[model samples]
Target: MLDKTGDAEALGFDALADLLNINRVDREKARREGWRTLADLVAVHDLENSSERRGDEWGAGSPLYQACHVALIEFIRTAPAGALPDPFAPGEIFGPKLPPTLTVV
Candidate 1:
């Protein structure tokens, strides 16, 4: 689950597990093994059944996979081209300011 934060954080593999319909065991095991990014999880699972992970494996078909693919791509495409400001530099320290559409239980 994404924390309520305005600062765009790198979307991790665990976050996309539901969308990918990845099993819980695989997700938890991946997390324990320090698989942070989608590419990392793919590498561990051999999603393509090949020696190396390929981006094309997730292309087209499978609505859930498509959603993840689009979301990840859009995230990278729209990312700012500069380093982010240090959140702890000085002054006010506020909690995350996420999108209003998101609701955390």
Candidate 2:
């Protein structure tokens, strides 16, 4: 699902629904109104190049909007002491993540 192309020319969300036999606008309205289906729950994400209405909503940070700040802070902390500038702090809505793998040595 990670479209590395990030092609802005790709089809809009509703146009895609039409191909799947659902009217796009109607589907979105229903989802927004809380009538989401299993497929809706899966497909409704902060996708790249969303419909004209969505207009690039989610940036480098996912919908939670903390990764960018975290990366910035990490970058600043790693910088040389005298050259480092105060970095912008990420908001306090962080959560746990899946841990990396390891093996007994």
What TM-score would every model get versus the actual structure?
0.32, 0.23
Clashing residue pairs for model 2? none
TM-score (C-alpha, index-matched) for candidate 2: 0.23
- Could you tell me the lDDT of residue 2 within candidate 2? 30
Worst 10 residues of 1 by lDDT: 44-53
Best by lDDT: 1
| lDDT for residue 78 in candidate 1, whole number 0-100 | 86
**Candidate lDDT values, in order:** 0.50, 0.43
Residue pairs in collision within model 1: 6-97
RMSD of each: 14.8, 15.5
Question: What is candidate 1's lDDT per residue for 1-105, written digit by digit as tens?
Answer: 133552113444645555455666666776688755544544335322223233555464344345556776787778786544545544425545554576789
- The list of candidate 2 runs beyond 4 A from truth reads 1-64, 85-105
Winner by TM-score = 1
Candidate 1 Cα outliers beyond 4 Å, as residue runs: 1-9, 47-105
Candidate 2 per-residue lDDT over residues 1-105, each given as its tens digit: 234553212655544444434445556665576633323322444221233243344444233223444655777878787685333434323533446678999
